[model samples]
Target: MKQLLTLSIVLTCLIVVAWSVSPGSTNAAPEWQSYAPPHWILGPIQGADGSEKIVLNNLDQITRAKIPITAFHFDAPDWQSCTGNLQFRYSDAVLDQMRARNIRGLFWVVPLIGLNCPEYQVALANNYFVKDAQNNVIVTDNFTGHGSWIDYDNPAAVAYWRSLLDSLRARVGNVLGGFYTDSVRPDKRNGVVAYGEAYALDLLDYTRTYVPDGDVVFKRYGVNTPSDAWLNQYAHVAYVNDLPTNFSGMKTGIERVFATTPLMPLPYNEFSGFAKAAPDSETYIRRMHWGAFQPVMENVPFGKQPWDPSFTPQVMQVYRYYAMLHRELEPYLHSYDQAAFEDQTPIFRDMDASRYSARLGNEFFVQYVTDYTPAVQIKLPPGVWINYWNEAEVFKGNRTIMYRAPLGKEPILIARGAIIPMRVYSNLTGHGTGKSEYALTVNVYPIDHSTFRYHDTTNGWLTFDVKGPTRRVALCTLGNVPSEPIIYRIASIAKKPDTVTEQNGAVGINTAWGTPLPERNNKKAVGRNASGWYYETNANRLWVKISTLGTDCPAP
Candidate 1:
């Protein structure tokens, strides 16, 4: 264990240097931003275990359906041989298709070098395999067959494996977007302590040197342990083990994920059968909604896509709605990313590890934990919060109640004076577009006074302030103000606004009389109430477009 700790320190220092010299190291984007976006950790889409033609068609169906996939990751039986050799049999046509669609390709890889393959003989001749106490080759059970792990501690082994990965990239093109570093702990190999963890670390070093722009997400075991403890500081993302798709497994998995807080900033739970199981549509929808509130979402099922024939119309509606909701929440998600990178704070966490409820420790009072049963209730921390869906449904915090939300509704709570940016669009592809047509709404809920710092690629970091007592709110651009027009939509306002004004970096409005043109295009094909900036008088929610405030009131 002590030797392992020393090796970890040395490797971490080297990796830190490699990370610093990587492509985007000097850029404004956070280091973690290299991976799939916060809301779209797409596809465990290990293509159907058949031929190359079947694999390409599976990917084609997803792209044709207009489903948003950030990256495409395929494991064994898709393109690579089962002997754990580096040989791939896929056509360049599939690579061209993926590139044309702007999707990243990720291949699954492990440290285990196949014992039966020709590479094993080469490794043995080169003395690159991990050896047992008797100095014989160490073989272990793997996905396809028995294999020996590359002795990462040996310089020759490291050079050989790194060359192999580089050779794979040469054959596969640069489409290889990093790897899924699988299984950190070896299957009880002697004469080596924590060799699996060391091997995974070296693999990451190779990825950083080769594909600096790509990402690496690991599985369980090695990370968070004492010998491999730096994972807490460097691991950008990780996921819970494959739990059963049933409710009990999901509940247990979610609880386990919550416990990984602050240590791992962006961890997710993998629930099986989301797309294929139509009978659990309701449960699936609820889980989907809950997933959006997570730090990162990975909802790929083994069978069909959610929008495919397997799902009912209603199921599709709910699934797509949450998917859109996830995209819409990107701006808010980045703040947490900034926090994790800059301050080592986990944004998606329970109030405490003991609690099951997940909380976004942002400026907003967002919590995503409540039972699905009728008359279900949730206890919250002390504060005043407004329901994000209805704005009228106000709740004083620190209590439980007979609050039963309707199906398909997630309990999104916003603090009274909180300000959250909204980038609204019809489809998933519109996320991070910064397009003018994508209505950017600044949602200010009922509050006294609050201030939030929001960051984006377009806007480096800006401060939004709300002075509730004086009925004044303003946006201060700490960096550059983005191109998207800022639309201030204040809810819980008592009276209507007669006029709107923009001054001192703040937009003021008396009433939303003739502002915020009714959405020119109705793009609610997903069945969500995609109402673009409307007010509910009885509900006391006033939504006035800030863009119209500075200019002539647009015709609705």
Candidate 2:
């Protein structure tokens, strides 16, 4: 018998575990709100000096492949030099191309001024740099040697830095999406309490003025930052410091970052660490496979393409497959993002972080450990779950099961009775759908009733509720039909439906008593055809398709 813990017990343990880093943190849970990041964010991790030609090349290839990406993060020479000198590369043509492709541009910014830059002179004249005990300018040395950090405690200094950012935005034709604020507190020797707070306030205020919907990401600026709780409310995302390319380091970093969930999910990256040694093709793919299931797939184009160049086709194929898979999961991922915003809960969670156990749960867990001599045991909540990768492998919940997971294929489970809405692939440039088509393929596990809300940037909030063979899908703002011929492909069902009927505010479908598919066996149960409904007796699964365009609705 497996050791079973109640929901309250699990939550209480999570709170206690989370208390290690964030002591005296409030227990007041906030209401969950919806949050969806821009479709994709691409950045170059290694080459900060990347030119427009390089960006254009990537954009062209990604476009041809129809890989979904919405925003580009500019670093190094494109925005500033590694030496902290102002470079600000890129031209009108660059901005125009990004605009044509419907991709927004962003770059890195820090609160440090190079001693040799013209900005330093202006700050020196106006006393904008942080002062020492003797009222002398305090200088710090970093990768970009001998620079003065922003003295945001002074009002005049804040205005000067804000104006500098304003000028950059104007220079870029205002096409930039947002910024990745770097090391707000690069040095702590000054002992300034408002170091990160000052920059965060200005950035948030600027976002509200210009791009209200844009995201602001920060490093070393939030509750995760020791002795700091300032930027937690303003920033949208945070990433752990760069770690080694080895598996243990990556695992430890993930645990640490996800453990500090003051708000939002931590975006995982392996490019920086991997770029140093440029690991073999197998290692690269493994690293990427680990990232594919995370909350946000931060595809930083830093190192050489993960796969060996000799096998370019294979590399591209695998990369494109995972990218598209991530694209296909937007509807599900964004729903959890919203839940995090309003409720202060993270969807990409760990079942137990303090003990360094691999068990993770947020309706599902992905196994990263390769060795399974004794088989990896996972503790699941009380319910039935179907393996997302292999629907045939179903687990009765409230128990621990030792299961072996194969490489490159992580086991993700969908709870029974859960209604997940998915948009079938239309194209890559426009995020799966090429046109304004309201078509969805909803996978319904064996369940009594379940409701899911689809939030689209253009379509707004659409609530979809499914009960048995009946489904209710409606746009919150519009009473009439949002799209013609709305289709629902219900999969992994237990009943065979013969006919489907349309009606006002609802639709009904009945199963047929057809023979199971020929391939239906004990473990592997069902496969559906487009012709009609099909049933698999051994696996107890059925598949059905329903349409609502030409079918007539009866009188209310």
Candidate 3:
């Protein structure tokens, strides 16, 4: 006889697990505001060095290599006519190409207007530039040349800056994703107006208005900086200040991420560091591993191409591996980002300050190796941790242990009751394509009971609950009906189940585990209606497929 269970029993003991989903009318914010940043943000290559040809070439290289990147960042020189003019230099052809590929164009902007540009004279005539006590325009020589800072303190100056942004957006059209605001330092001042926290905050807020739907405004702040408190609300994404391109720089970048992620949202640093000479192959791969787990995986290489002959082939291999890994875990990362938005909870939680370790929500814990040595000492939190790379290997928590993390690998431990939801790998995010259906794989490591609240662009919200006391495990689905079939891979099962049943009836146990059916003649192939159970003796894992077509489950 089928066992009957009460819904309240499952609801009471289950740990809540939430994963990424499509934005719905859950709050007062815009629907797009609920969306997280893309998994990979590419470019600003060589800093302030950008051209139409350069941007196209990099995109071509990345696309050919099958590396998925949703956004491309153009440095200050790309849009500036004479530095800070806020002009559009790229032709319509460039914008069309980006739009066709569903790629977002992120252009760099600043508060200063170059003295050589006509816009500067207009601002000066209108008293829009910050002025000294002597009533003279405060001209400061920066990287771009002599420029006057726009008086964000003055309403007229703010309106003029907004007009410039409006003009640029009108020219670029839909491909203009957002702006990258740099050089908003707290130290800039004149005798009358000071560009401090309020100025910086207002500038960012104004810049965010220009960003189109499903885009972001990348700001540079929050590493021992003065405006750390306001960054969370102002910027969509916050980046660490530039660091040297070396092992020490990687360590500092990690420390900075530890410091900023607690207060800010989507904190990241440029992969391979930003200063000094280009990173060696070792530093590049190691840093890339760390970047894969960050809230945002950004790649801004300095010197040669990532696939250039200067670096070893392993560098590109590791880069591609981690890039795909980041995209695969998008659903997982997006869930935490959404949580940080709804509640003020930190996305990445620090486990130990002395050790470079942190937790990504409640699912996984990561320990980074800062130096050249592959041996790492990890202090685990209280629980049972399963090695993500090797599911069979498990360890008890609250004790420190030495683990080997060679190149191309890092220490990632999954909690015992983690319910990870993932999607198939793709070279693109299918942003403008309007894709609706997606195949989902839900990995469950059941202990007592756990629930996963999964979300996506197509399927609004679906809940998966797993409960077990001993060897018997029961899985249930609630909320919206899934568009496609779901494959549940239950891990750590010591033996094959005697019977697998759903609401319909008994589920057939396939004796041909890991073997393709006659129709599909591939090793890891199954039919669309492949709803059954398969047990792999070697791994002690059970695979079950539940078909959603013409089936009804309880709604949440």
Task: List per-candidate RMSD values in Å.
Answer: 7.1, 9.5, 10.1
Judged by lDDT against the true structure, how good is candidate 1?
0.55
TM-scores vs. true structure, each candidate: 0.77, 0.74, 0.79
| Alpha carbon deviation, residue 20, candidate 3 (Å) | 25
What is the alpha-carbon lDDT of model 3 when measured against the actual structure? 0.62
Best by TM-score: 3
Q: What would the per-residue lDDT of candidate 3 be over residues 1-556, giving only the tens digit for each residue?
A: 1112111112123223221221111212222234444333322212224676776777777777766666677765555667777788767776776677677767776677888899989999999987777988878785535778777667777778878877787887776666555554323432222254344445444434545243444444431132543454334466786787787888788887776665445777776677548888888888887787777777765555578788999898888777766766777776666556554456677545468788977888998777788788999988999988788889999999999888887898999999887654542321101111145567789887787776653665666677673565666666666666666667887876666555531122222122221222221342234555556677777666656432233211
Ten residues in sequence with the least summed lDDT for candidate 1: 520-529
- Which residue pairs collide in model 1, if any? 416-446, 416-447, 417-447, 496-511, 497-510, 497-511, 498-510, 498-511
Please, what are the lDDT tens digits per residue for candidate 2 over residues 431-456? Answer: 22332124454455635566565555
How much is the lDDT of residue 135 in candidate 1?
Answer: 91
Cα error of candidate 3 at position 425, Å: 1.6
The number of clashing residue pairs in each candidate reads 8, 18, 4
Q: Among all windows of ten consecutive residues in candidate 3, which has the lowest summed lDDT?
A: 1-10
